[model samples]
Target chain A: MNHKTASNLALAAAFAGLLSGTTARLNAQPVSGHEAGVSGAAIAAGVAMTAQDDQKLPKHSCKGKNDCKGQGGGKNAGKNSCKGKGDCATDGSKPKN
Target chain B: MTLLELQRRMEQDVRRPLTAELTMQPRTTEGESMDEIAAAYIRPNSELTSFERLEIYNRQYWFRVIGAVSEDYPALQALLGDERFDALVLAYLKQRPSTSWTLRDLSAHLPQFLEQHAEFASEQHRLAVDIARLEWAYVEAFDGAEIEPLASDELAKLGPESTLALQPHLRLLAVDYPVDEFVLAVKKPEEKAVTSGAAQLRQANVTTTLPAMAPEQRYLAVHRYDDVVYYRTLEESEFRLLKALQERKTIAEAVEIIAGEEQVATIQQTFALSSELGWFCHPTI
Candidate 1:
């Protein structure tokens, strides 16, 4: 067979092997790192040093209009600071505080 | 002025860029003095001048928006440092104001914004853009829609012509740097007492020296499993196959696309892992 034909045959064999599910043993090897390229030990060390458990779910927030109510602190506490100051000229609501 | 006109005018005044000192600019976009603009509409109380009253809103507006953007792009903030990141965000917000009610959509255009305005990222331009993209993917994966995955029986029914859909929340990214690890490291929950609200923004700005990362093509799948967002690295062939499947290509077509590039064993592993992970779903008719 020519080089091109040989290459095509090899590819076909690869596909056939994949379709037959013969590679489960290889895939069964545990993947602990976020990236497959990185080793599990390295990932473990990185996680241990800095991050929370990688498998644990993160805190998910619901973003609604009132969701930012208590967030009016720190440097961005603009809305809260100006709330009773009658700073909003167009809203027509007078200072209530 | 009509209420509508007054609302528009007030919005225009409030949304104007803050000065370098983080206070309201003295002049409006039309070159009108802010004092003159404020005097035209506001009724000053005994304690404050009309201009000061207006300045409060302007400063507050800028601070709130700046804080919101900072919260979403902490990794980018670390990459570019505080001063430049603030300038970049201010520039971005000016060109593309938040159209949505929620701040969740605030940084949606940030990745593209960084691509067009590379100077804001300083010398780490490419890495900054990659980090922004990765961070945005985290945002999406955190809240993106979840659909029922196709069952194993459904997989058997999928032929060369039968197309499959990947989960909507699965974000396939090709970045020029390995930003996944860096972002995870930066966003790692603080080991100490957890704080919330705008205070979190102040605490979020702890600066770290940007690590030098070599430029290499990295493929990532930013996905949410259970309720948590996770990043997975993919080999080139696996990436290609997933991308092809995402494009609604038939199983055969996707397989054909990646067959030459990957080993038989690797391909088999990819399929098995993908199926087990429920990456594939039936396309909506």
Candidate 2:
């Protein structure tokens, strides 16, 4: 699953050579043993995660219909999920199909 | 109590009805709500319908949290079926309160949650946990933090005599099932396995059928690559060495521990693969 390309191979070797950079890492908190700053990562990652989830929404059914002719729902259903068409109730529970 | 105390209680009560699961516990700030609570905000304006304003936060809040969590653990939901997944997620919301401000933070503990919960066992809930863990790590790697990582200078600083510390953000996981494989199977562009159920048959292997290694220990290391969280597995020796390092073992001691094992070309290959995948930060510098 992880065979590297020619470019990635070079990157790997370069990373290997960069071991000198991490010396400060060893110095930062050798005694405590836990890496700090996880909360920052959590929040940053969370924003991206949530944004990605939002983009993946499933399409709603009531996009079409000229007159709101079908079963439109009541006030509680809101404009987003409810069409408020004929035979439509307040809750928007029934599927038009 | 004082007016402030009473004000907080009323706010909690008002917020309670906004939740999709109204039965879910309220976030009573600072302490318990007083017998007589004060209103934090004026009652919904009679001019503008109360339901309109309230629905904005109520539905959006519920959908936002649920949607965010759904992405992190899609495979788990796929395994559980829509109805069961929704029910469990609702229960999950109540039992485990959100401590982290973001929904992704809420996912960090979901795997552990499903494993311990009795309601989920029939699905071989362990499998669900594995899927969730992998999904969570993938999300973490997709957009997490990054450090330049350790450099050769840092590795040299150890001097072969000193103990080395492992980064905290790096996580090591040992799982049983081939969850990554399963996840891959679902993500294939041609067919959407997540929607279509029926567990795909896997190649029969010693690990799958044999009782000795029934619960195969799949070693995984999770760390950030540049700006994202990425992970790869290590071999027996590599895992032990990292474990030793995480435990603050000296280089000489950790190497000594590994030297006891059979050193073959494959082991070195394993280390190379792991190191390439950001398993180990640059040595020390």
lDDT of each: 0.68, 0.48
How displaced is residue B143 in candidate 1, in Å? 0.5
True contacts kept of each: 0.10, 0.03
Q: In terms of docking quality, how is candidate 2 classified?
A: incorrect
Question: CA shift at B63, candidate 1, in angstroms?
Answer: 1.6
Model 1 CA deviation exceeding 4 Å by range: A1-97, B189-211
| lDDT, model 2, position B153 | 52
Q: List TM-score per model, in order.
A: 0.74, 0.57
| Model 1 residue A96 distance off true place after TM-score fit, in angstroms | 15
Expressed as tens digits, the lDDT of each residue in B97-190 for candidate 2 is 5557455576677777787885864646777777778777766555554445445555445444566455456665667776655554443212
Candidate 2 structure, TM-score to reference: 0.57
For model 2, residues A23-73, the per-residue Cα lDDT tens digits are: 333343324666655442233222222222233443222222222322112
